[model samples]
Target: MRLTSGPAHSLVQLDTIPLGDWRALCDRALEPNGYYLPDWEAAVNASARGRTDTSALCVWNDGPPARLIGLMPVTSLRRAYKVPLPALVSGHPYGTLCTPLVDRDLAEPAVTQLLQAARQAGARALLLRDVALEGAVMQAISSALAREGLKPRVLQSYSRACLDATGDGDDMLRDALGPKKLKELRRQRHRLAEHGPVSFDIARTPRQVALALEAFLELEASGWKGRRGTALIQHEGDAAFIRRAAPALAANSQCEVVTLRSGDTAVASGVVLRHQSRAFFFKLGVDERYAKYSPGVQLTIALTRHLCADPAIASADSTAAPDHPMINPIWRGRLVIGDVLLPLRARDPLVELIHAALAARRGALDVARRGVHILRGLRTR
Candidate 1:
């Protein structure tokens, strides 16, 4: 296989080598971090399932014991600055606080070499959006990349609250709940258990994850998400990928998937990537059949309580829609935040103008909503 970058601080043109040798690559690269998991390729493939422009960039050292310092998920496009860059960047899929996973020892020269490859590949700017600003590794990455003259912006406009799950069920609950919510949840617990005993299960292998996913699909299909074509299983590859990924990612001591079941059936499930005290909620699928019982809400309560029981798990992260009501209440502290960062270089002036116009269009819709609200208020008065 051809090498992308090398020693002596020499930068080679980075072209993506195929996945022919990824098994060996991942065997060496898979740890708590670094971008060699099957899921990385799977995610790229998932995007490719729809678009043709996305490309996965992997840059590594050349030698007997070669190591990868960085992998940037960039897509080639003719629009901006001419270089390919990440699609869901600023740490894709939320709450990873992870990069492609670089060897700290070789990070500087390797990233410099990596950036050289990025430039040669036609990228103008590197965008790391929706990221945390205070973490140690991130600080290191920021400093190193800044040396290359790349801009890293820290936006305080958004923030996320994560739950700590290390104590014990009660302690976890105490931390995860407020007085009002605690009482409401206690009532929910009583209501739910009356129908049947509610329980939680943890799945750790591909086979187990697959079965869990199958059940999740069935439950999800029974819900409105299936009608809207939003079920994870709607796309066979996504189902397969999640099944493939959850197990592999769970291998990390911090990685775990929690399930809340009603008797024998799963009503709610959450995939959390526990890294350095943070339980990043990777994926969640709920059965709405128990909507009256609010199985999902109850599950979150149980998980939050369970998480709050463990001190090792500092946070139960809900890296979902910022405005999502379900997650905002589970955690008591804000560890991170997110925003959709749009790339500017890929668009022409006309395209930029159109996007700007779209923003105005959305503003008009918001105003119309307000007007309707006012009309209702006036009629009620």
Candidate 2:
């Protein structure tokens, strides 16, 4: 389907994105973030059953065969899940990041068109949540909305830990965890080694990822996440999603599975998704039996060193919650993530009410998180 040009740029719904154009956009226009990959989107859409249907708005520069500039996935919420007003969000139940697929250079025009089209398309509030604050998406959205006389409310903000994989290995580790902590970690490793030789493996080949994934799922299922029923293997859809996505990612050398073994037993395992020079540490699990020797931290240290030494990886996202006890201290680098609420209707009162509710929810969550941190500190003391 050909897109007729709007006043500034052409607007097309994602379903209307011409055949083969989605592949081109993913290949050429997007950054190497796995969440933005076309395959990932397909998987998310395939899995969307009960919660909400996935929707997207595509923006293009005016052309006979219009040049695609930006694409953002959004879901409509209308009197569903207790949400009173109609809303749009750039995330799904299974996905992590919410960055738009826009060229950094064409961000302004693309975002301007996107916002205009989204409003006209009957979105009452545009929810840009779980996205990087310093990324091109946030920058473009902030500027475009401000210029359009829209003041986007920041519903949530937090510092997410990440790893600079391009740095000198020794120096980076020293700065991140400190010498004393490293020494303590080393001592812990020595204690674990007394049981058997502890080995770390980074699985890249299809066979390796396949094998490591099984161990990973099992290890994850044997932990607190499993007890809480939040582990990937515990969720049928999430488990299937990983099983389907990991191999495709490995085929392109975009996936890595790491494992820490003690003799014949797997103690800790993790999954990392790569795209170009960036990697996202997706998830990990450790045996509760190895808690004393800190197998999880040990595995992370090994992965950190491996990432730092790898010439192909320049950065690694922790993909962890802000103030995560396990990853925060180990990865000193931080990435700003925030949720922004943009009004979709002209002088919309529903947007304001939704924002207020969201703000209240976020405030309560923050207080609870602080309480958790305080309790953790007390426990440590």
Candidate 3:
């Protein structure tokens, strides 16, 4: 791959790549790649409208046909007067789980070339996060940047869960819960069924998704989540994003609702997301009136069975909090990845030192709040 460098505009370097070029590269590089999804499209749309200041480019293999083998999102941060101006190329507000959208074979070269290009453009540094594709990408790029005399660091320390689809729902549950927890899960499930008929439905069509999401809102508002002002459609930003992205989010799949219905009334409900071959239990809400039955736990069990019945899915990706009791027990296998943490690095040496000292004191407050109990025990004892 050839390299070129120069500040693009007020943005700097590769982000200076015209938007047209960026999108064209993104579309070509990601469309047929392993991790392509509508979220990427949404990111592009938002970037085009100035809601974002991210830039990216397609890396092509060295060949006559010139195939798009990788892509990166570049962001420029202005320096604070003291430190050398450094630009960051990362999966920012625009990304969470970012894997290069190139032929798997070209992942290494693509990463190396992209960073070298950034260096040539005069960026003092770069960072990559939420990396899901190749470890080689991070290592190779960081090495390339280092040879150019700039310090590059790769931090590999985060975990994400991915499901493997091989056995019956019973098997999956057994794996998640082991012997003791599985017994509890079964007990809760039977208890819920005794109350009345419990229905777990995944809504794919537009009408059904709309109805189901509406119920999710109601369920969320019924419990302590609502008491503390935590609702699914809480903030206008969240509601607006979901509304705008609904069509694209559902183009490949829809919202999964696990509900316990006694006659016509829904007693408990949880929201699930089925995307491609992965099914995620994203959110859940149970009416406080139905708390006696451990609705959330039972709903999870039913969803596990649904996952078994669906041949397209493999593992359950629990977006549950790191220490979630119900979810942690049920998900044993782990896939660790990188997290993008943005810290202020560039600034005037002496003055910035003062700022850093102040920031360190504030950072200690974050470490002190370890027992922040936002979630109460809605689960049955």
Candidate 4:
């Protein structure tokens, strides 16, 4: 249903978004975000936990054939942030990044229309989570806000590991890991190889990806994540979402499942998504029995080489937490990600209230987490 009277903008249920228009927008998006692409995001909205309530704020260019210029999947502020406010938050698409898709040619107007649509939806602000703080899309957003005598406020920010994949794969790895670390990794690889001929394989075709995803799910379910009940396979919705998403994205050459195997045994695997010249390392699953061999790190090293060797890929986002021990050392590059608050009106007081509420909530959560940790420590002692 249209959320605004103007044909230029509307808020419609996520699953109801037109695929042709969505794909067209994605093709010419001002900043590419694989997580927001139609195939990936649609599956997420349909099957991912807590995503069923998503709605897309869509901006259209009213041509003889209407063209979609911008789209962001969002949910109610109460549901997303538990703040009971008139706002919206970017819907989680099973990835860390949530930059919206905006047509590069119509970026300025599209962003203006997007904010207007949010306003029409009765929102005083828009909370975009896990967006690239310095990316092209954010620049467009800032420009749009500036014209309205408003500005986007960064609520939270962190630097995540990324990869500069433009250089020679071997040279990049050698420089990043250094001789001593590289030698140790090599020794680990040699010891691991005693199990069999260790090899790295990539699945790009839909059929190949579908098959490989099974191995990835099984491998992930056999590790620490499994015991902690956090593996995708442990949740029916997460499993269904990925199962549907991977093959569909693979069909368009936008997805790959990489596996590192020792003979017939799959030691580690990961899902990677591509958009424009960038690749996102989505998630990794490893057989912890091979932890001593650093199978995850070995797979990552191979993935680093694999991505660097691809001429079309200029960079890769690790999509990991800030200062992630596993990938920070391997991929030395960084990308600033943040939760930004876009005020719908100039100097809206609600914006400040929302910001304060979020900060307080964050502080309380941190304190509670510390308390839990201390309590557990005391119990153990």
Model 4 ranges with Cα > 4 A deviation: 379-381
Across 61-115, the per-residue lDDT of candidate 2 in tens digits comes to 7767567777877765442324556676675535456777775556678788888
- Could you say which candidate leads in TM-score? 4
Give the per-residue lDDT digits (tens) of candidate 1, residues 1-381.
122333422222222444433434443331233222445444534442332233445556775566555554444332222322222222243234334444456656555554565554444444444445454445555666566544444422356666555556665555556677778777776776776778888666655665665676677666777888877678776566556656666554534567777677787877665544556666677877666676777767767766666676655557665556777766555755422223224433543443344346557778999999999899999
Stretches of candidate 3 off by over 4 Å are 1-36, 39-68, 73-85, 92-102, 120-122, 132-156, 178-180, 224-232, 254-262, 267-276, 340-365, 368-381
User: Candidate 3 has what TM-score?
Assistant: 0.68
- Per-prediction TM-score, please? 0.70, 0.86, 0.68, 0.97
Local accuracy by lDDT, each model: 0.53, 0.76, 0.53, 0.91
Between candidates 2 and 3, the TM-score winner: 2
Positional deviation of residue 342's Cα in model 1 after best superposition, in angstroms: 12
How would you encode candidate 3's per-residue C-alpha lDDT over 210-247 as one tens digit per residue?
Answer: 67767777788777787787563664544454444443
lDDT assessment of candidate 3: 0.53
Decoy 2 TM-score against native: 0.86
Lowest-scoring 10 consecutive residues by lDDT in candidate 2? 1-10
Judged by TM-score relative to the true structure, which candidate is superior, 1 or 3?
A: 1
Q: Tell me, what's the RMSD of every candidate? A: 6.4, 4.2, 6.9, 1.4
Q: Is candidate 1 or candidate 4 better by lDDT?
A: 4
